[model samples]
Target chain A: MKGAARTIGRDLGRIFQALAGLLFVSILVPLIWGEYYAIPALVVAGLVPFAVGYILTSRFRDAARPGKLHGMIIAALGWFCVAIFGSLPFLLIAWTVELAPPILGEPSQTSTLAAFTNPINAVFESMSGFTGTGLTMTDNEEVLPRTLQWWRSFIEWIGGVGVIVLTTAILARPGSGSLTLYESEARSERIHPSIVSTVQTIWWIFILFTFVSILLLWVVGMPLWGAINHGMTGLATGGFSITDNSIATYDSVAIDFALLPIMLLGSIAFPVHYLILQGDLRNLYSDLQTRWVFIYMGIGTVLLTVLVYVSDTYDSLFTAFRYGSFQFVSAATCAGFQTATDATNVALGRWSAQAQLTVVFGMVVGGAAGSTVGGIKLIRALTLLKGIRFRIADVFYPETAVRRLKINGRRLNEQEIRQEFEEAAIIAALWFLFLGLGTFALLIMLPQGEYTLENVIFEVASAQGNVGLSAGITGPESLPTLGKVMFLFNMWIGRLEIIPVLVTLRAVFDRGGLYR
Target chain B: MTVSDIPIVGDLLESGAEDRVFDSLLLAGPVLILVIAFLGRSTVTVGLAAAYVLFFVAYVLYLGVRR
Candidate 1:
């Protein structure tokens, strides 16, 4: 086959691999649920397509690793297929439950599932889970089966690391190129030459942090299970709280404070932490991205705290600061756990609007390039900031002169800086555009006017940022089917970092095979 | 790909201990506030945590400056 045709085939195969992985993982949930009755059918449903995909990909296994753009294509296609297959567990579970033990007098044989069983709602929940967005399809959280709830948060943990990364690591592939691909997808900085070593190191560090966080939570009087579960989700920056009220259920300032470090660490990039742990400590300072994330969090927290305090929502200034800081980190890391009622309380809830917007902006800025956290990322944010400053300087000077932008003390050429800004701006703009469209569409559908455009915007931004903050507008009962689907899509795209999914789709449709 | 095997940190310290200390304080200060606020579960807990966090943060800054 010609190079162009070969490229097309390669992209398709890659896309299928992602889809298959998602389906495979989704099927595991039924096994976890001990629903043995559903296993045979779920296996058949999931494995048939996967087997076909596996057959197709065997030929392409030796294809030279793809370029960065192609890398994006693989990531995007994988997320889309995963999101679609991720819905299976939701559909099967919801269908089985709604069918409810087969009506007694109706011959109690094998039963058919309901047509409007809200599979889309379940898909939204699953996508949100996998994408690390805490948005939900179900309303009454306490009523949902414990196994499924754990599965949702578990997906958040799994999705934090690319499914391929976990699979590749378990299989123990030590190739540098494979390592590069895995690091690239998870957006983690490479800590070692070999991909497997880097992945293992990252996981090791992540586990260590989680263990420490669990200890802190437990010391603060949280149940051991909640502590462990919260530690896992919190460190991943994937906010899927077990309790319906989120962190609010604890009602302990200690629990909120205990979570603060975990969330903050979650928001910072892993590479920075790795460097710090290595005792190179200077990377912590010389790293522009790390510095700015702290600056951003500091300013945001203080501002939001003052807003909360002045709004008279809480009696004490410390209470205001406590919740304010927690909300900021939650949104900044795109984690979205809330310690206070964000939507209903007119004062603190109202303050959340501003806090949520700031976080949406932060999510676009994101955490460090390698961290599990989502959004545009801090490096891009720093790059854009530097570029903007340089552009302003150029306006004052003559265009004929060379203008260089420096981040942390190193200089980058104008063209390189411009390219960085262009990438960041394009992704950020697209993210907001999707959020706007999703919010407007939801507003048109829902008859209830309880939410303002700001509220809808906040929720959509939350979904897009993969930040879980809600204005009490989402969940299975409140949001219609279409709204849930929209949110789910947003979370998936946001998690994949947008470009990959788009490139993958373009590859799928391009007649000229110009996807690259 | 791994920083553990590389020498990126070797170049970082050439900037000296002052720069390192400054950066650490900058990063640690906000984290401190967050930690205190989080640990203090109530309004009173927040107050106490805030006081403790503030004192520690100030001490860290002084140490950084001294370095």
Candidate 2:
């Protein structure tokens, strides 16, 4: 028991140390940008975690390696800590901006305090940023300080892959429970032989993608600042945009096309990225998940285009197809970039119910597993599909007959197939069940005639799937307290891919299960 | 060979034949209620929504036990 406690303590210390480093790095944004007044707040945030972590690590010098459960606990606790510390800057900046209006820029109609005055709103924004869910509490994003905007995008950039994974890539020493920590983030595929090298490779590729995306966007006529911000969020599959209208503000076909590859790269798994980098195009073409993604996008886009065009939602077929394909891709990839004609109206909000439902389905299916994007990942979807096939095939087989189930050219025995089916079914079931519960909760809380059930379901699924396609239901000022809490919970669970959060909850609540 | 002894389609058919009516009813109950709720907005819709929720919860518990 003592030994286990020591191990847990040591693991937490390592996590806190990583958090300290991240917070300290965050301080540079304000300092470099000459927001000197916020420096003290940032410094305090950095030092507290660093000091506590340093003491714990020093005290627990002889701690043992962590098991899987310990790793899950570290991930859950690490994110929780990061969210709290991350909110400090938002809270302090909001307070400061409220006190002295001209320090950053022109004051907006809404007080800056509205962004963070309620501590829950600040934490919600921080959590949304870190989870790569683009839900924001900032009513006037354009008027916010550049420092806060940078912090928001930066958190999502780091969080796109994962915070713990990033720390594991950079700071985790060799053989110090590094693999367990990596696995805890629900990433099992390693491109390199060692966890350290694999993480490094992933980060390098991510950086390359980010740079290329920025250059492409800038080349396509976006302002340099917007390009940089969008590049980070896009590659991270994080939906936060500086403009209230999102990607639609530019209204350029070239810009939409430019974002496509970056969003695709963000949604594809890191291992697949590695393979493509190594000139293995055949694997990319033949991979089950990749094939399914293409098919889904193609079919969904076409159907949605037809639906929208027939409904006369847009004036031209070309407009319908353009928006239809963009929204479909965005939804499927779990990248939340939306095309808006004006500040308040998004293209998605104008679509028919059937058209919107297509996007919701895409959000549920989501991007590839081992990618930054979230959903009931494509791999699991494939598993369930294969299971259905296997069940159908099993009915005709003799009592003694044995059939091998294959996915992506790899065959699975009966036992493995059964395990896969159960895991896929349970997770998918829970996803839908929670989605229903959240939708129902929103329906109860929202005032009559204000929002439709379809819009509520779309927003709920967006939060639950970590797909940030909003249908006018989610906004900084409009969301109810209950709605905010529900979405916060959704983002937390969705980012962790449901299992770690569940394991952490069980370990915390079930005393007997903790030791086991 | 008999139809049940054939491949693919036969197997699917056999599976359908083997499926219990009670299980099918359990699966369909919530779906039907949800559809009804979606089609209209009234006291009946509210009742259907409640019924759907109850059915969904029970079905999830059933799945947990079966697993």
Candidate with top DockQ is: 1
DockQ comparisons of all candidates to the true complex: 0.04, 0.01
In model 2, what is the error at residue A459, expressed in angstroms?
A: 0.9
TM-score for chain B of each model, two decimals = 0.35, 0.36
Fill in the DockQ of model 1: 0.04
Report candidate 2's fraction of native contacts. Answer: 0.00
Q: Pick the candidate with the highest lDDT.
A: 2
Candidate 2 regions with alpha-carbon error over 4 angstroms: A101-113, A340-347, A512-516, B1-67
Identify the CAPRI category of the predicted complex in candidate 2: incorrect
Model 1, A1-516: lDDT tens digits are 244334334544544455455455655555654654444435554665466557646755555554565556556655665666666655765555665554311211122223215667766776787788887766545455544555666678777766656555544345424643564364646676666666665655565466556556766767655775787788888888877678887888888888878887777666666666545556666788777778888888898788777767676888878888887778888777888674323322365455556645655566777777787787777777777777777878876888677776767786777777898788777876787788789899777767777777777778888888887778666787777777777887788777666666676767457554
Cα lDDT tens digits for candidate 1, B2-67:
422345333222222234443343334335434544563555544443454355346545644554
Worst 10 residues of 1 chain B by lDDT: B9-18
TM-score of each: 0.77, 0.84
Candidate 2 steric clashes: 1
Candidate 1 off by > 4 Å: A1-53, A56-64, A99-117, A171-180, A183-188, A342-356, A398-403, A512-516, B1-67
